[model samples]
Target: MTESDHRAKLFGTDGIRGIANMEPMTVETCVRLGRSAAHVFKDGTHRHRILIGKDTRLSGYMLENALVAGICSMGVDVLLVGPLPTPGIAYVTRSLRADAGIVISASHNSYQDNGIKFFSRDGFKLGDDTEHEIEQLTFTGRIDDIRPTASEVGKATRIDDAGARYIEHVKRSFPNGMTLEGMKIVVDCAHGAAYKVGPWVFKELGAQTINIGVEPNGRNINVGVGSLHPEVAA
Candidate 1:
C-alpha cells in the first residue's frame, strides 16, 4: 500500500528471490538493488569496492551484469568471482577487503529461480537494519544525484583465482596432519556453484573421488542431482 510496505517485502530471509527474469529478480530490480547497495556501502575518499559471486544458473550472467552496471553507475568498483559458492563470496569479500559482497544464488532451488544476498566487509550477512537501509534507498529516489563522472566512475574486475582461494580455505579446516590419502569418496556438486571446485578439493587431498553433477549447463542444477538426489552419488 505504501513504499515502506513495498520495501518491507523486498527482501526475505535470504534476500530477494524469485523466478529468473521475473518480478523482483528481473534485471531492472537487480540494477536498483545494485545501486541501492552501492549507495549504502560507498564510504569516504577510498575507492569503494563490491564483490559479487554467483551460481551456475543461466540467468546468473544477466543478473550479474545488471548488478555490475548499477554498482558502477554509483562509482563503486566491482570484483566478480564468476561462480563461487555463497560462503566463498563472503570469504573472498573479506580477503579482498571489499566494502561489501553479493551472492547470486537460489540455494537448493531449481535453476529457474535465483536470489541476491549481501555481506558486510567483515564477511558476515548484513543485519536487518542494514538490509532495511538498502531497501529504503532502492525504493526512494535518494542518491540519484550522487553520480560520479569520467575518472570517478567505477570498473569491474574478474577474480580468476577466487575458486582456488576458496579451496585453500576449505582445506585448512581439515584436521591437522590429516589427509584423504587411501580414501575414496563420491562428490555430487548438483551442477551448482561447487561444480568446479568440489571434486578438486577431494582430489587435492589425495582422495580417489567419483564425481557426478559436475557438468552444469546452466539449466541442470538441482534437477535430479545434489542433496535432493543423494542416490546419484550413493
Candidate 2:
C-alpha cells in the first residue's frame, strides 16, 4: 500500500471504529492502539492506570482482552469494567483518577461492527493531537522497543462494582424530589451498552420501568433496537 493509504486518519470524532474483526478493528490493531495510547500517556514516577469499558457486543471480550494485554505490556495497569456505557467509562476514569480510559463499542452499529474511543483522566475525549499520536505509533511501530519487563509490566483487574458506582453518579443528576413514583417508562437499550443500567436508573428513580432490547447475545446488538431505532421505544 502507498504511504498515503497507510496514513488514513485512524481515529474519527468518536474514536477508531469499523467492522469488528476487520482491518483497523481487528484484534491486532486494537492491541497496537492500546500500546500506542500507553506510550502517549506514560508519564511521572507513579503507577499509571487505564480504565476500559465495553458495550454488549460479542467481540468486546476479544477486544477488551487484547487491550489489556497491550496496555499491561507497556507497564500500565488496566481497570476493566465489563459491558458498561461509554459515558460511564469516562466517568469512572475521571473519578478513579486514571491516566486514560477506553470504550469498546460500535454504538448504533450491528454486532459485526465495533470501535474504540478514549477519554482523558478528566473525562473528556482525547483530542486530535493525541489521536494522531496514537495512530502514528500504531502504524509506524516507532515505540516497539519501549516494552517494560517483569516487575514493571502492568496488571489488569475486573471492577465488578463499577456499574453501581456509575449508576449512583447518574442518579445524583436526577432532579431533587422528582421521582417516577407512579410513572410507567419504557427503556430500550438497543441490546447494547446501557441495557442494565438504563432500567436500573429508571427503577431507582421510582418509575415502573419496562425495558426492551436489553438482551445481547453476541450477534444481536442494534439488530432492531437502541438509539438507532427510536421507534422501538415508542
Candidate 3:
C-alpha cells in the first residue's frame, strides 16, 4: 500500500494518546509517567538501567527526554534507541540485559498521538502490581524516598543505526526470493516512527511507492491518516 493510502487506529486499552501536547498525550503527563515508572522499578538496587525506544512521532523527541529525566531522578540509567519498532525494543531489552525497556510510541497512530509502554527484565509487559505502583507514585508525589545520589544519577545515551538493524530483521520474515518489483504500493506512516524505514523497505523490494502521513508536525498524527483511520487507506 502507498503511504498516503493508510489510516490511523485509535487508542486501545493500554495507554493514553492523542495529538501531541494535547489531551491525554501531553508532555506534562509524559514527565509524570516517567517519574511513575522510575518509582515502580526502584527496588533498592544500586545499579539500574532502562532501555527506551520510540517510533517516528514528532513528539517523540520531547517525550523521550522527559521520560529519561523522570527515570534518572530515581537513579535509573537510560539507553535510547532513537527510532525503532515496538518489537525491536522488546528484543533489545532481552539482548542488552537491561533492567527494563520503555517504548515511547503510539503504534500505527498518527504523528499527533504518542504513548508509553514498559517491559520488565523478563521481556514482558510490566505486571499489574508494577503499573499500579507507578500510578500511585504519579498521584501521591511520594518520590523522595527513591531518589538517587549524585554519583548514582542516571545518564542517557543514543544508539544510532538501530533502525537499519531493525529493517534487516523485518525483511528476514519474508520468503527469501520474494520481491515487490512490479507492485504499486502506498504507505501512510502517520508521520510517526516508521516514516523513513517503512517506505525504504518497500522501495528496496522494488515496489513503486507512494507515501503520505510521513510528515509529522507534532500535532497532525492520527488526525486524518494512519492505521486507525482506514478512510485514507481505502
Report the number of the highest-TM-score candidate: 1
| Per-residue lDDT of model 1, residues 34-143, tens digit only | 99999999888899999999999999999999999999999999999999889899999999999999999999999999999999999998899999999888888897
Q: What overall lDDT, based on C-alpha atoms, would model 3 receive against the true structure?
A: 0.73
> How well is each residue in 132-177 modelled by candidate 3, as lDDT tens digits?
6665666465774676777887888787867776677678787888
Model 1 per-residue lDDT at 204? 91
- After superposing candidate 3 on the true structure, give the runs of residues whose Cα lies further than 4 Å from its correct spot: 1-12, 18-29, 42-46, 56-58, 107-113, 228-234
Off by over 4 Å in 1: 1-5
Candidate 2 TM-score over all chains jointly: 0.96
Question: Which scores higher on lDDT, 2 or 3?
Answer: 2
Ranked candidates, highest TM-score first: 1, 2, 3
- Summing lDDT over every window of 10 consecutive residues in candidate 2, give the lowest-scoring window: 1-10
18-113: candidate 2 lDDT, tens digit per residue: 887877777887788889889888889899999999998888999898889889999999998888898999999988889999999978888888
Give each model a TM-score: 0.97, 0.96, 0.75
Q: Compute the lDDT of residue 123 as modeled in candidate 3.
A: 65
Question: Candidate 3, which ten residues in sequence have the lowest lDDT sum?
Answer: 2-11
Global lDDT of each candidate: 0.91, 0.87, 0.73
